[model samples]
Target chain A: MSFEKQKTDYMPVELVIGQHRGLLHYIIRPIVGDENLVDDCFSAVTEIIVKNYDKYDSSRGTLAAWLTKVARNGALSFVQNKKYAMTAGDRQDAARMEEVADRKTPEDHLIQKENLAELKEALKSLDKLEAEILLRKYYYMQETRQIGAELGLSERAVEGRLYRIKKKMMKKMGGAIHD
Target chain B: MTDFNEIKLEELLKETLPETSLAENLGVINPLGAAVNRVIAGMVMTTITLNFLGLNYILPTVGIMLIYLGMRTLRSGNLYFRLGWLTALGKLMLTTLNLVLQVTPYVSLMDGWGLWAGQAVHILFLLFLGLGIQKAGLDAGMTNPKMPTWPVILWQAVLIVLALTGINSWAVLIFMIWAWVRMVKHIYHCAADLKQAGYVVPVSTVWFSAKPLLLAYLAILLCVMTGASLLVHYTPLDAEKLVLAEAIGVKEETAEIRSELISKGFPESVLDRILDEDLADLGSVTDVDVLQSGDNTSNTERMEGYSVSVLTEDGRVKTFVWFEYVDGKHAGLVDSVKIQYDEDQVTTDIKGRLLYEKKGETWSADVKFEEKSRTYLWFGDITEDVWSISKYSFPFMADSPRGYFTWWTEEKDGSPAYWSFNNTVFNCLRTPLVLPYVELPENADRLILFGGFGSSWGQDKFQIYATAQFQ
Candidate 1:
């Protein structure tokens, strides 16, 4: 109860967290795949940042800018940890499985897969969040706050995630089959 | 930026991450007590250290308050975050041990392995603690952005060890102040963190101004240390003469010297005989006096002769003084004593800040001797055209170089004895000439001069301020 410097309206971190919820979702969703996995990544990131909140130095960058870096790195660390967890033998098997799945594609499925892969690669050319939002809103259907919660996201995060999906989908629509 | 947008976490990692089921945001909870914990814990540690070994200071109320605070923090889940509290506890424990050992007889730093072990542990504790703190946040200098790497911890530990040795007390103080400042920054940020998490936290009384307050404490400590150095560094002192004068007391000034000289097997009533015999050129005077400092007769009956003084680097001075048996005066041990005088004050520049010791500030030395006793004295108490009584650290009564039964008082076991040479204690290396106490004389020039040939394990060299002119 004795920690305040002064009283203010609204939870302070929520203001910042609210502003960047979309970006955070964009960074996290793909890496984690499932909603529960997304929550795990999000929780660890927010905890690391919040616990070390006092260490934020504005000289390095603005708070908004710093948060972006932290979110990116936190997700990276989570994914990297998972990546390194598997033994070399397990990783080879996994890679082999992916190759086998690629070879088993239907003749028409191959064309479609190539089309989607090209689209995905083209989407990477633009800002990722806007692209992901574009793709999800147009293609994935209504992404309600309930879905946001299920993905361990604020309502704002779901909106941003859709924006990135759409933005990336647009790049694919334009490039179509540039490769 | 060029990475595929569709690339998923599952695809990148060959294995699935061990996921946590935690959904609630525990980080948002208000850290109301951490602010309180820092303030109260700091106050407790400061009070205990300043009060010294006096049992009265460790009031039951304070102890109870600390325990209560610890419990409160532990309950609130901040005990892990606030490990700094442990460091204060360590200082408290070590200081208490020093007090206890002082009262116990036959227990010394050399003999007390338990105490030495404790001191070692405290040093290690502080080192590891600093490393931990570094990990939890950014350094004050802003050079570090995250937790301390292993190399960072190693270097921090090394610096602390040097600081404990008195080789870097000032350096330690500087770094510590910087750390406190940085920690204060972290505290304020943490408060905002809680607020951001939707918690209404109250204003902290001490945490807001903790940085400036820490700096202020350091400033006051520096002021006290500076005053002490000026007293010892400015004056030109003859260590040999000062040691002899202090060892013998103002007996030579009064009729006490005559009585003491006769009682200890000196030439027949020199005080009366010298008055009637001396004209000039008093050469190589020698006498053996019954040492009062010794606990036993074997230690009591000791003899002494001339001692010499030499100027060391800067304005510092040292003495080569020794003591022998009253019967076997030649076979006695040599005591290496060092000193300072007020006649040679020098302005010191600390961290680019111009500082000067005042004139007429008496220079004194306080060698934290062994646990049993300590030898200390101030020079330059000129009275009635002659020097009055000056306390000499050489506890032996002008008898042996290896002083008989001198008071040996040590704060930490296995700590070096250089700081307590004559009357002053240097806070750091670079031969601090900080402050306080008078200077003792060397040779017959009626001058108090201090000059030395660095410390050595060589045979004890002795110096005399002036010949014993019993007038």
Candidate 2:
């Protein structure tokens, strides 16, 4: 009942990661790019987590969902800043590779990098609203209502929009998008 | 050789897959969790601050902090920042409630500049909160932004008018209820989010329950309502008492006069003339001092009394009679003059009217006055008019009944100068009690009798008698 006791009993970062490592990598690594950047982002995220550990209210959102959102924001900030530092030629190459990778191949099941690159390309093609919804839903794995509120739409509206966008993309890929 | 190599590679890939996935998920989840946690911590802290320091001082500071946090959350693309913004909003409402409760007593704080200031602050903050919600929604990519509709705008305008015009306290109460409902709805939405995300939490079910945050809000509300209700109920009584007290303070200084008559000396016929004619013209006496005695030796000694009468401009006469016994014999004069007025006109102005005006020109001759008992009683021709004789009583020396009357007359411009009548009656016993009454002329624009002290026996000791003129 008391926040004071809870505040002092915070789990260590290593232990939290060890316990929920699967969900963390599934949600964070795609947005961050590479193991080294992921490690960097993780440290930053844990620093925030430890510093504001007492602030979390279980009433607002699950600990996992809240943590995922924090990680995503940090990763996005990192990616945006990195994009600015890259040369124009490098940007164009990255964009082209991302686009070409979107084409499906039977060999994609064996090539995790190719699948990831194609997924990122497909995400980029989405409208800003749709992309954000999908990111909050699948990427950060937040609840539909939370995404709806963040976006100022009803929960049903968010759910419908996400469903339609996914279906459209799935049709485009001959139902290969989900797999 | 090829089959052995493939099997070893497959095992290695399976172990690494869960590890990499777990790491990526942790990276995504931890940061958001941290941000949300921080915002919730801020809310709890703010609630505690509000409880300890009171809403007035803490709310403004919290509101400003919330605005800052809202902007930062939008820029940072952190949903948890919205929590700070919402908490700030709740605090702002509480602050407003505090201000309203504090200022409503004694004067209409909602009138004049304070009203405008309060409205401006409310509108500005409302706009800020709306904008913040819209931007957050856009960032999360849920739906198009929609402004509040015309009806909502109109409702807000009405609320503003009611608040500024010093409408009843219930108007403020309605607004408070509205705000509470909205906040509760939003809190429910947040609770739903928490539940969906697999966190267990309970929404507040009772209003003003003893929980820390809710109890604080309830305490503030209770204090305001109790104070306001007391002010509304007791103000008029206090005002009346103040006016009456002022009147009594001035009236106490005047001295009363007393005179006595012996029944053996005055004849019945001569006594009748004095009571009927002479008593009528006696105007504005400070007191009628009376002391009477009877001759016990005379077997046929007649019981004595006095009567007083006043003829009005309407050609009708009004009379008052008093009767009493002296030295084992009934002897008195009812035709005694007694008037009581405050020395200070300011006290008169403050006390206002409290007496009934007597009408007619012919004064009663049959009644008699008594001096020994300091009382008035009927001793007229009892066989001729039993009812009249029984109803009349001697006017007490200490009692003073004074009244003022005015009527409306047409002015040169065809407008009516409405006239007012104010009367005050002082009844004496151990202590004097004053009663006031006022009347206004028909078709007058304004009839104001500023002050009259009522009998202290009434709940309101001073009655402000006023009537508006109508054409």
Candidate 3:
């Protein structure tokens, strides 16, 4: 299609909703300890994106970078307002709850749903330990200590072994990863 | 074939944007741009005022005006506009004040009552502006309504009174004008917003163009030029005169010589020798020649000539002259030596190897002469002019009181007799006429005196009068 025709085509609303749904769990799951608050923040971000679509300038920066800035600002404002509203004792209780929630293991179900057949096949070729470490680190977002414990090694040892494995994997894959 | 995964990937990246935008869509007056305008206006006014009156006071007045305008704007409900105005005004005021004070006596005002009054007024104005703006902002946040006009009027009245009673009346007048500018900006922004919203808000006749700002900047340049011109014309003409007065305590010729010797960093003891004894005024002895035989040859040389001139203790004047040279030389042939003194030091232009030492009650000199071969030639003329010579015979106590007197007078053991003028008991220590006399304790080893006063103390003259004990 010509550039003019492409520009004229109306953006599908389902596409925006589908994108939000796909990334919603991953983005909020790490930050908001409370599941209910995570859902609310996710909804707010989606609503803001829809409303301010006309103001977005393609020339200034990438969509992802701009969205990230907005998200961070929103999260900071939410935290500030929350601190002002809570009493000293209530804040302490909230903080403790957040800490406990953060310590819970992140589910790796999203990785299985998102990766393509080719990417999955590449991941399968890695030795079980290397595969499991990479998956836990990137997909589940687990801390190195927890990952190391599950794999039966010290965190430092796990890091060193992971570094070597990544290097080898990158060479074998020949520029498969975008970053 | 349609790729389901490719479609899914594209769909995952799309998200709805926020309804609220960072950029304000409502029409508002650009406060920063308006402040830039005011600053330009101030600069122009300052330049014009300086050109007409040869004064630099307008710069600070302009600052006071800007603050007034900023406060006025802040009261009118737009915080950003006030900030912009304040920033511009503050920066310009500081810059112009610094420049003006650096080049003139205006900074001396800081030592007077005007300084305190000015500071108090400035502090009050700043406090008022800050409080007014913050209160208005908080009120707006709470009420979700525009600022009431009465509070602004009351605040303006208070600000005006503060300005009028403090430092100068001009400061208050300038501030009032500034407040007017703020009100204008607020109205302009409000009107602009209404117009944007399709309401027909009336436009003002006042035109805010970049031209006014440019002109104002030109005026500042003019003020700077005027100040520089005044500085050039009014500064002292003779740097030497100024320096001399600072170095030595003399007001005339001695100061000149002191200035010269100080610039050269000559020794203080040498200067003191020339000042204390009237050696500068001794009579000349004619045709004094010396002949020397070197390893290779023999040579004869006659004295060029030398004169002694009496000067003030501070070396300001050279009153009398004593000349000596070959018999055929004219009377005007000899130039009187210039004596320079500063604080505790003195100096003269007798430039050759002449050893001067104070022993017991007398000053002794050992002179070594050389011919002008730039090498060791033992042929030269040596002339010694003693202004005052004292001869004393101790045990018999023959004291010559006509010459310079040096004695340990305060001894509790009655009178001690002197031997001979050359004897250790009869040696007369030379003290410069310009130096102050100080008493020492019975067991004191030495006495030292620093004479010149103030910051430039020995820099303008020679510091040459310090005493040391000889065992």
Candidate 4:
């Protein structure tokens, strides 16, 4: 198809999110503390995809992966910026985050921030297959069986990928994450 | 109430992002862009390896291509800035040395040095690459360089272990491919960081264009190495000449040879008599036949067919010279000498006197008697009393055969000399050479000429005897 034709035929945010919601859930699940606010991240994730729809390029990655990344980035931005965040279990998570922050040196905190930025850069360096797999596993939060179906792999293969992404995360953390 | 609220919120996102056919309209991520660069890197590295074996002819050409590749790698941030240049330089140095060794007459020496330098440069390339990687990390805004520590150290260790244990080249190739992949991964990250920092990177494309040039360079290198080896196959003898000269304890030049001989326990008058003879003429030898057998196996090996003999006037110093070859090329001369001193007894005894000495006064006879002496010695009645083999076999076996003899004597330490041939207790007498430095007994009454004479292929032995009468 022509470039213009492809660009005009953009996939809507809802359908992309519908397919990859499970992936997005799992990526934010570790930091997500609120029962009521779990789905709140989804709205922000969807709105970010819709707002940045023109920037989404298929030559870079798949629609599902792009949506998942947008979702992941938006939710992370919310967690960091504390925007639209209300008290379901958000207060308890904030308390936990603060408690953890108090133990680490400010220098370590800065290092972590720097590492987080590099991790985003490392994401671009990943091969399309690895990037896609990471997106489906951590961002979409799908079960191994469902991700296996989407990627045309066995459940065990998808499980193996879960371990690999964990390693990738650790690498992005510059070996700071022990477990 | 929170769970009910979350369910309500989930209903909203699902309604918003429902599955649509628009997913099919999106452009696909092309794997080949990154893949093309990988192919170029692999081809360039293989080219580097082939040329690094010292193929000098096409090395500069390949080096240029590698520099281009290196520059591209640098532009893409796939290579650390300075290391790309160093790798190219190291490879060129190794390849040039390999080529020089092939064409030069100094093959043995250069080859030894090249081996050491090749391995040393290879390790240095790795070091440079590591430093380059560190630089790339610093540029990428890393607080501390997260150079994939385990992979780099562990993989190089694996390569070393494989090399030390004599692993096959295939295992090395496999490891290289793995290393290349991992290296590309690291470079991709660096490149990505650079791209984000507003750099316009040039990556390798046009894959098929480079394949033939690299392959052609390899083919040319192979042909040159083969041709050069054949052209210089005999060059190793240059080194071997020094070895031969050292063993013989003499210089190869005629004047130096004479001096070295006289200096090293040899009498000057003996050398004077033989130095002007045809025996001193030098000839390049292609083969050797061990005409006489003795305990000098090592000396026999160095015998390159050119043979010389000298006898001292006192019938004591005997020297034989032979030529030697190294790496199928003509080398130098080696000398073997036998010296006898008069005592109560010599090395061999016969009947009741020393085996080969004039017992009293000399019995004079015309020398150079090649015809009658040979006729009577082999076929005529001279063997009537001596043990003679019944000649009934081949024509060449028993016939009018010829041999020569010489006898020289002085008052034990005379200057002038003659040549004769005499084996030890083993019945030599094969090639006639002078036995030098013999002192006659005070009451000696007889003479024995060439005591070690025996018929070839038969045990028929004879010794021409002359009575030496002292008034």
Model 4, span B1-471: residue lDDT tens: 234433432332222212321222222212122322432343344433342223333444455444434433343344553455455566555665556454444545555567657555555554554455455445433335544333544555666676679777887788688786785566555433322221122233222323344566567755665455333321111111112123232434555546645554334533443322222332222111122222232222212221223333233323232212222321111111122212211212110000010222211111111111112454553431211111100111112111122222222334332322222111122211111111111111112122212222222122222211111
How high is the DockQ of candidate 1?
0.03
**Model 4, runs deviating above 4 Å:** A1-179, B1-72, B75-79, B99-113, B131-145, B149-209, B233-471
Per-model TM against the reference: 0.23, 0.25, 0.23, 0.27
Residue-wise lDDT of candidate 3 within B160-220, one digit each (tens)?
5675677557876687667656654553433322212111111111212223433565477
- The order by descending DockQ is 1, 2, 4, 3
lDDT scores in order: 0.35, 0.36, 0.34, 0.38
What is each candidate's fraction of native interface contacts (fnat)?
Answer: 0.00, 0.01, 0.00, 0.00
RMSD value for candidate 3:
26.3
Q: What is the interface RMSD of each candidate, in Å?
A: 18.1, 16.6, 24.8, 19.2
The CA lDDT at B401 in model 4 is 19
- Candidate 2 Cα deviation (angstroms), residue B238: 17
**Model 2 TM-score?**
0.25
Which residues of candidate 3, in runs, are more than 4 Å off? A1-179, B1-107, B110-112, B143-471
Candidate 2's residue-wise lDDT over A1-179, tens digit each? Answer: 11111222366655554444444554556666576777776666667666766777667655665666565666665665456447335766756655564565767555665444444445446675675665555545456755543443456777678667665544433444322
Error of 3 at B197 (Å): 18
Model 1: residues with Cα > 4 Å off, grouped in runs: A1-63, A66-179, B1-77, B92-471
Assess the local accuracy of residue B42 in candidate 3 as a C-alpha lDDT between 0 and 100: 44
Pick the TM-score winner.
4
